[model samples]
Target: MKLYQVRKGQFVFYKNELHKVYSVKPMFRQSVHLYRLKDMEQILTRAADIELYRPKHNDTFIFYGQRYTIDQYKKPEPGDYILITKPAPDLFDHYSLNEIEKVEEVHENSVTTTKDNGVKHHEYVMLVPGKSEASQEIAYYDKELVPEEQRLKDESISYLAEKDVTLQPYVGDIYLDKRNNTKAMVVAVTESEVTFGHGIHVHIAELLDEESFELIYRYSTD
Candidate 1:
């Protein structure tokens, strides 16, 4: 960890025990001042000697209306299911649940990504799940915060059907492709097919099929 990354009040592992950062003196080589949470014993240590305290294996939390357990804490690889939180949306994105094109780098508190313009955006990295599916077997840390029955009802296909949901895709309307879990905007709509900017062409008939696609955002002229 760099000196800039160390913040007072953050939890860290020092001397094999969880300690809270009490203060930092940048002028000194041993800048990180930590106090043991259990006994309040204070100690000064170098930034490189300590490790950030994060959720490890089996630690569970409610993320994006679903519960997940931390499988491990490591750098992310392609195709791996990781939980990422975007600060702007204040939501978690899981591989199986959300539209994530790719993960570039996973940091202790943030994930960095470079866009087409070469500007980087930092998003919070929550966890890497052993499995992407939400389970009732693992007790969630925030179970009391969000009831399981309510989450099930919200995500249920039957509940969606009851609303008589309809999609009328127009130019610039955004939709999610259920087959690959990708979001695309309608760039062109013809009698038979709807074309997206990324070269995705979907048959107009598929829009009616719930398994095929779902409307994400509607573009209105008004």
Candidate 2:
């Protein structure tokens, strides 16, 4: 509430949630404080209700009642999250599922599509997460390459791309490794390799292929 009463790192209830005070600043005649907030409820809600799935190399999964093989798996950058469901060639648009319905691992290849001409072009199938047989069907879109113009027209996608940080793997750049599903800062780099870690527990890996790794989070220079 009041700036003078706020202490750095103190927790306060604001905007219907708890926020930790980050820093205090004096601007002209008034003082301001920065707050960091985390919504555990929101995170848990998403975890309990929706899951995002990424395609792996050479993997095949059913979409819209059709089977699609991963022709090439390119890790999506942070900006790509906004447009995951948009049409893209050879890319399994990110899949989102609510907790109610489920998709099981594929044992055999299959393909299915919408039949009614009047219905919107979306395909769907519902399968038990453990069992192989489908219990219900849901609506989803088959893959297609969305036009660049249409992609740019999406305001959220455009906004994130504008704010995205582009960094070459360097000593400080943060890297997201799809293979391990982890994030680490590049602590050192050589002509053909990279080492990442904070202090005494460094891990070395081959120089990252730009085509396979994505830049999601970045370290700020202040």
Candidate 3:
């Protein structure tokens, strides 16, 4: 079947496959930035013909005569396609694409080394939400969520931003301890001045990760 947009009109595979104009957003032009619903770059960003159509909650995605659900689409990059229909089980509400279902097809002649280098002709893409549209390029590096600055950004809150010296809790990021493996809820973070305790009010991002610096949510790492 032919692919098209979700709006009430004939969609002719425009907007660079991933990017599209929203019903409430500004008009799209050559210089204007664009954002897709989900980060398509995580999966089909490199495909010569990146075609997609969202299935109903119970439907399936058909590709090259094969049927796949959003869950099955979470193949790692460079070998197969990865799509996201669910969030991380450990992280809070953060949609994820599993990187474990990756399957690659490579040629022996593709590598020119005597020793088997761990190098295969494949892409390794772990997509996180970005904050900019192409024309309205933006980056959300700080803890505060800037709606106007970023076109479409991942819901990450930085405690180190200029907006708030005390970092607020973000939706999808990890609260890592010194080990990077043992994590907890970030609960709060301050640059060099703010003192955190049950005695004072704190940023929302910091509160969630207070106990373990870990957020309860869903994700896939492969």
Candidate 4:
């Protein structure tokens, strides 16, 4: 796509996967010459095209195209690269590329790893929904902690208080839970607490005064 055609919230093929365009910086000294694109680095990893093999004690499994024997039931993590030498399933062979459905929502969670020197790095898990529980895997990952520039900005509690941010829940209002790096919608709110669409509840004070919480903004898809 042309530089001018790209917009925030649009999707683009980045690093061989779908990345949501978070922000776009354009430089036009002469005529729309250059632009910078920043995107949320983690996306829902596509699982529909890949095959997963879990082995029982001493059981053999085929991966990509190689056969390996396992002594115990082992699970795969986000970063393991499997060599695919096997032929694809019939379902994949007959379908056209345009007929394939892509995963859109990827839930993110973090794991912290510390070095011997006490320095720490973070890795993120990208969960793909809609698959069966037994089949669902950590479809994608952020290998290292996201840089601050890639993170979503949080509005300070002091700033929120100054703005009179109240726990007046309204549909489409987005709230960020810094503790989990998750975003939820304000589905309902009472005088004492705010409830999210995921059925999570937080006290008004915690929602407004806690450093782990932030009021990103109120928005409506409609």
Per-model TM-score, in order, reads: 0.28, 0.22, 0.18, 0.24
Candidate lDDT values, in order: 0.50, 0.29, 0.27, 0.33
Q: Arrange candidates by lDDT, descending.
A: 1, 4, 2, 3
Evaluation by TM-score, superior candidate among 1 and 4: 1
lDDT of 2: 0.29
Q: What lDDT score is found at residue 221 in candidate 2?
A: 75
Ordered by TM-score, highest first, the candidates read 1, 4, 2, 3
Better of 2 and 3 by TM-score: 2
Candidate 3: tens digits of C-alpha lDDT, residues 92-211: 222122211222333542211111112232322222222122212212122144454432223223312434333334333344432134444323444321122221222232222233
Q: Write the per-residue lDDT of candidate 4 for residues 81-198, one digit (tens) a residue.
A: 1111111323212111111111212223221111001101111112221233244211112313444433222113333334444444466788787655688787876543467776
User: Per-residue lDDT of 89-162 in model 1, one digit per residue for the tens?
Assistant: 32232221111223445445444331111111333333454345542322322345556685465333344333
Better of 1 and 3 by TM-score: 1
Q: Where does model 2 exceed 4 Å of error?
A: 1-3, 28-30, 39-196, 200-222
What TM-score quantifies how close candidate 2 is to the native fold? 0.22
Tell me, by lDDT, which candidate is best.
Answer: 1
> lDDT by residue for model 2 over 72-184, one digit each (tens)?
22322211111112222223322221101112122122221110011111222232221123211111111134345532332232232243324234677676654355676
Candidate 2: the clashing residue pairs are 65-112, 66-111, 123-140, 124-138
> Which of the two, 2 or 4, has more lDDT?
4
